[model samples]
Target: MPQRSSTFNPHDPVTLQRMQSARSIHSEIMGCQLRKKKVLELLPPFGAGKDYPPQPPDIETYIVEFDGADDPMHPQNWTVRKKLRVMTVLGFATFVVAWGSSIFSPAIFVISEVFHISTVTAILAISLYVLGFASGPLVWGPLSELYGRRPPTLISTFTSAVFHMGVARSDDLASIMICRFFAGFFGASCLAVVPASFADIFGNKTRGMAIAIFATCVFIGPLIAPVVGGFIVTSYLGWRWTAYLTSIMGFSSFALVVYFMDETYPPQVLVEKAQFLRRETDNWCILARQEQSKFELSDLLEHNISRPLKMLFTEPILFLITLYTAFIYGILYLLLEAYPIIFYEGYGMAFQISELPYLGVVVGQIFGGAMVVAFEPMTYKRIVANGGRPIPEIRLIPTMIGSMLFTIGMFWLTWSGAYHRHVHWIVPTISGIFTGMGLISIFLSALNYIVESYLMFAASAVAANTFLRSGFGAGFPLFAGAMFKNLGVQWAGTLIGCIALILVPVPVLFYLYGKRLRTMSNYAPT
Candidate 1:
């Protein structure tokens, strides 16, 4: 019957009307199916009902997405210069927050003298700031996912600057502690969100180098802080200037972000585009798929707040990597205490001079970053060979190498500093290079691995990692003095080294079995 109709004239009114009506219906059905597919793509695979409620069938929905693979509005398609501008702002924000964590560390003694508190109690200035890091991520990570990177960054950074101002203006220890903790609470937004931002702008081919640069900033900030803080504390500017300077930097970061940073998260970008489209077309039905989902407080608590902790416990890869990185992070902070003991007390160096040794670690971090950058071509080759799919385990190779270097550095510093009276101060300081390289390598690898493995859920994974690592960082300094004094530099360092040695197999095991683990994971891409 259709074949018979094909011979009919095109100009026949009934035939033309019927054909146009059929085409219209077919177009509407296809459009509906396409929108449905996109909505499904946006919804969380598990518990989609709880997270994103189903839209009523009576409503016609228009889902907005990138124009195509080459959409200029997409972060992935942004010019290199634009991405770097955003990254520069984010990286500086990360550095400022990390620098804030330890800048006050050099002022502990001054704080103790002013407040008539023990050095141990004064250490709370740093500890509380780091502890704030742990709590801040729980809020910032979810908010970033909900609202996008820019809002949380601006709000938190500005608030953090105000709190830093409060710390600068405080007259009492209680006020200072409160201000410091809140500053960190806000500042931790950078730590929790920046890595995810990096993942957004950089693809798999170049992400390792980008993350290496990020990890270098993270590891080097505290190291650099003691150096800068030592100068600030020892100078006529005094300890308050430490807070003042950090505040200035924080404010600067806020300004840069406000002026330079564009929203990078794809879903949030689509939401903005959808809003613009709705305005132009006067069609309220047009919406980003993410906008269709109602944001419930209960859903936020269940998915955003609790999910990271739940993943920490349930995911072997996340838990082990978090544990491994946390321990290294703790030792890094512990060195804030241990370095002074080793160099200042043992070798009779001045406080500021003792802080100079941290530069060795800084140099090592540079080397570690170079190492990661150098490996990028090889990784790209492997990715091409594997038909464009990246292997998460390949990221762990540097981690394995870093683990051994970490252990080696620990023992080297332990023995050299144990004989501080006999050994040249340079001996122990030289160990910092190895420690720094190892630290950067391990941290960079872990971060990239998690991002690659988890894909969309990277922010939550990083928040979990940050939570544990900050806990260790905050706790380690409190016991560092006692441990170094009681166990002696040699034994205490040996203890840390042995633990590091135990964790050395983590990357290796993951490298071998990561695919299997990822295949079984509920959240990670298989």
Candidate 2:
């Protein structure tokens, strides 16, 4: 081989070609920056000595980007303690709002007696409260997208507290119902936003556990509320104290959130970061959240409100899951109506003793939540590791299990609670465990499936879920007394159980055909 020459030629074609390639890359990178307005701090400095020299332009770029995996600004990269704090606040807030709904169940009879209204009329408070849950998400979900999660969370929680206090102070039934509805409407912010917040911070592996925990609190709150409310209603403090208690709890939670929870929405954080960078670096090219910041009131109503409704009707998967979840939710509240009459008339128990039966459901939910937390993540991680994508079908397995349990539980509750043959109350209450197990398992699975499938439109998908389930939850109580009275406990419960049996095939069919359905879907993640 000839000896290599040490001198480099300045006019070499190869060197010229390399220079041209570098310029191309530089232009593409600059174009990316201008289009997204993202500050890509990871890029090499454009200096004379740099290998891929930046092209000379009117403005020099020193865009701020996340520092690899260690960027502190990234919510996922925050300290584990910080993530836990966020979870705690969100979980507690969800519990408080849920409690606000059912705490009034024990008070319903009291309100009826005081106002000389019928039982069904009194139940409108609970029903309307749940209706607020359904409606609020249509508005709040989009607001979270438009603003930051933190602002929506704080504003909603504070307004809910104010309304809770309004309920406490109200003297008339109309005023109480109005206050309760508005309280629930505002407090539903957590239902709409917190799940997405978890998605913002957690990877698939950890999100399963987080969802299980959050969902447990949600299911458990309403279950436990009757117990607490039962005691409060009978106490010297009376029914209004329940609202006062909720107000105090809500306000306390609001303060905790204000102090601890930082903004978690990635786009919002990026926008703030861009604003800071623009101020620091004096660059006008960075435009953080330009699109979101421009949304006006009309735009918010149309996109956030109308879009979810459109999706609700148009998206088949969302529609089916919502219907299924709503049916189970309706039955759960129906049980509340059925339980009071059964215990009061059959066992001669006061409202406090009657509410004791709800604990069984609470225990079952805890069991269901624990099971989901324990094993689902292991299997989910295994599936992902074995070359499977995070398909929505992964969640359907639990829904099947839950549906079967729900069916059995309803029939069991029928035999134990509705029968004329004298049976101990513990038997029916024990059956409530199955009800909780099935209800919560289905809820967790469906929720996880929706979020995983609708990653891009998770908020809108959740709004649909909220709308249907809460709608059922609200209406079911109104008619539950009538159903139980007309059909008797056995047939009434059997009817619900039969419906649940029919729906068992839903998740099963979805498990088999979900991918194909997703292929046809406009919103589902491919």
Candidate 3:
């Protein structure tokens, strides 16, 4: 047996407890006396109790190559001003992407006239932009993981802006359609990038509020675009000016991003820095062992590209929520399209006056946005109290109320219009306010919960949701007029309302069984 000190040194504590009874006494003695001593001496000297150097505490504390701050790649340590600027740039870019959905609302008649296309076909142009929104995120979501956010954002914004410029100068329907499609393709990049940007900028505790703010901006953009477009179109600025204005907004957003946006992708930044350090010092060991070895480009490509699609296909929570969201989004666009015909044709109103109905959408969004911000923290607290399992279903409270309001509003508006009741045009408009408010609340709550449930893959989850939603947004408007004409106003709205009603239980069910549901779900984060 080998003898050992019974007492431990506080400053240089023994790592191994017993060497002999541990079955490796001789080897341990050699290691401690010879190998360990040599290794300790080879390491830099540790501090004594007194006369300490004024070095950074982190430097002396951690044995890694650098403290977190020393790594310039960490986004958290960035200046507050710099972070805010990046957020602003992303927010503006998001606004541009969202604006595309409603910018053409006032220009529908103009589009019909210029293209000599039927009203339904012309409406598809609006749908196509949203379709681009739906699909763009999936492509961009994967690409960002592969290439980093900056490249995709830059390329998408620049290209989308250029397409809008082309739209402004387009001669015929073919050119305009081509420009719009390209614009949507580029515009979709922002949708993919914005939420990811939020994830990078805000901590988990504060992220929900930040996301709500982003959602507010996103929702507000579409609502306000129509109002702006109405004035632009009514002023004889021509529908092309709408494209021009949106292009200008996109360009300004691009410049802000170029100047302010710092790289938030840790892997990409570290990889780049590692390559630089390897070049400068020619030391392969400069980075931590975990990051020293580069991953295979093929593996990264496969994972990045395939993962979102895999999750989209496999995740039941993501799939169902996406379906519901798409239906909601479709109904929204359907309602937008319906407003023109419902209020103007059915009631006999002027074009500028007809655009006033959009006020309902705006007012509703304001109310919903406020409610989300106010109620979310309470819900979060309640869920925590119920155990750590916060179910996605609880979020349905707002959605259910909103959906019922949506249906009632639609029914009331339709019946009022059909009967030529005592109410002025404002009556239906007021009902529209209720519908818009309810729809936005439900849509936003569903989206927020999905994002939370799929935190690891938030962009991809949202992309899937956006795809379904945008598909509806694009397709619904095309049938709005025909549906109204064929089914009659009351029945058309009632049918859509009934469809919305079926989804009411979805949120409630999820709220109760969400933990179990998420447990069974493959795509949901554990």
lDDT of each: 0.84, 0.79, 0.70
C-alpha-based local distance difference test score of model 2: 0.79
Kindly provide the TM-score of model 3 when superposed on the true structure, using C-alpha atoms: 0.80
lDDT tens string, model 3, 301-378?
A: 455555566776788777777788788777777777777777778778877677777787778777876776677777
Candidate maximizing lDDT: 1
| Steric clash pairs (candidate 3) | 127-474, 326-469, 393-510, 393-511, 394-511
TM-score computed on alpha carbons, candidate 2: 0.86
Candidate 3 lowest-lDDT run of ten: 13-22
Q: Model 2 shows how many backbone clashes?
A: 1
lDDT tens digits, residue span 1-526, model 2: 3333343444654334323432432332122232223435546576887677454363224333343344567676778899999999998998999889899899988999999999889999999889999999888876676566899899989999999999999999999999989998998888878887877676566777787777887788888998999999999999999999999999998999999998886656666887877676676566443222333455446555676788889888888888888888777778778888677666678769888988988888888777667667665776578454466677777788888888898899877887535888888889888889998999998888888777535777787788889999999898888888898888888888888888889999888988887888876647
Clashes per candidate, residues 3 or more apart or on different chains:
0, 1, 5
Question: Order of candidates by TM-score, top first?
Answer: 1, 2, 3
Which pairs clash inside model 2? 41-65
Q: Which ranges in model 3 have alpha carbons more than 4 Å from their true place?
A: 1-83, 272-284, 287-302, 380-396
